[model samples]
Target: MTDPKISAFYVAVQEVNSLIQNGGTSSSRSLEEKIVEHLENAQLLGKLPKMGGAQEEVFMEVTKHGLRISAARSRLVKLRIPLIELVLLTTFVDGFGKTHAVFVEKSTTTRYQLHLLQLADDMAANVLCSLVKNAFVEAEEASALIEVIEPPSPSIA
Candidate 1:
């Protein structure tokens, strides 16, 4: 017997990978778009917890440096994406720029941790914000660029 939740999660991850491989932006109806669509059809979005408050509102946060996804707990579970992996991904996104998207996938059951990245040009960012607003239907904390600071070197004996 197959675990249905795991299967669905894998599908989402696969969709994300496909979208990134193709020339699709967060604004484009690419992998993230398709995965979200599937969630909607399955009625998974609302079934999950909202991000901030009672009045729902959803949007993607794209600072000049990074991309963040909110309102995606029930539809998809969060998994650890190590810092090294994120760096590699960001590099790829920079290379792709507006012409392509970058994504990562991992599966423990069927699919576990999956993420997508796109070099957000101003226009793409704006469009993505709008689409996320419509689909997410919930407000969330602003996404900030994660700066990994190393601990200061310990004094030698």
Candidate 2:
């Protein structure tokens, strides 16, 4: 199944690329405006769904990593992605666009590289795999006959 978040991320990336191509001079204002417009239109800043238990912790960790943008400048620029949603968003639904995951090594005083990954298959399988791994193992084969039990009439009391 095609994930909607992935499509939205692609659209956002295309918008930014088009803006950059047409922005003439490489001005920070122009690029920033373009990002604001696209993010607002996509409505990704809205509320994210609740994920309980261990999944929530994983979601938090992924979010912390997802929006780790590094920029050297004089102006204040802030980008935010809800932590939990990003895991799912970037998984099957969201694309990296111009931005991507990276590892920074302070020793070099530079970004190592931008790494990209697709989430579709991994996200879907993780859920099922976790369930299977956690399920109890039974020692004997258990079979039960199908039976319909109707409630007795209330007046019987």
Candidate 3:
């Protein structure tokens, strides 16, 4: 996040269908390709094509609480999502020749969103995805570092 060269981006956001996933053992590169294929299939099926309403210039950052999306100038929060609730994040180029970062949220409805972010450029998208995925992995590792044990209850006389 502290990279001096991080670029500012104008981003479009929209609620979308969840992405299709494969068996858990695939490599990272293959998983990304799978996301692209799934999205293309979705578009061909008349789903979530060119659907983002508007593009807002935003200063997005990865925070301890999760990813925080803010209005670029005013700094007001647009969306704040806890990473634990974020099921998946991937990037793909769309039929309209635009790139997007799509993710699924598991909070309640298992909803997903497509962000037509400028970060969708190949290098930027890859970097952002890696940052998020690595952070999520780190969070899971931290939580699993401890073991929980149940205490026995005393018998009443």
Report the number of the highest-TM-score candidate. Answer: 3
Tell me the whole-model lDDT of each prediction, alpha carbons only: 0.33, 0.28, 0.60
Please provide, for model 2 over 124-147, each residue's C-alpha lDDT reduced to its tens digit, 9 standing for 90 to 100. 435422322232111111111223
Query: Which parts of model 2 are misplaced by more than 4 Å?
Result: 1-15, 25-29, 44-157
* TM-score of every prediction relative to native: 0.23, 0.20, 0.60
Span of 10 residues, lowest total lDDT, candidate 2: 51-60
> lDDT tens digits, residues 1-157, model 1?
1111111011123333443344355565654445444334433445422222242122234332233334434433234433223312211212113222223443332333333333235455345444434322322222222234455899999
Q: How accurate locally is residue 61 in candidate 1, as Cα lDDT from 0 to 100?
A: 42
Total backbone clashes of candidate 2, pairs 3 or more residues apart or in separate chains = 3
Model 3 agreement with the true structure over 1-157: per-residue lDDT tens digits: 3521223354445554433333255555554565667667766786643444445666667754577777777888777678877756777667776666765555556456555455536777777776777777777776677444445789899
lDDT of 3 at 8: 37
RMSD of each: 15.1, 19.1, 6.0
TM-score, candidate 2, is 0.20
Displacement of residue 83 (Cα, Å) in model 1 is 7.1
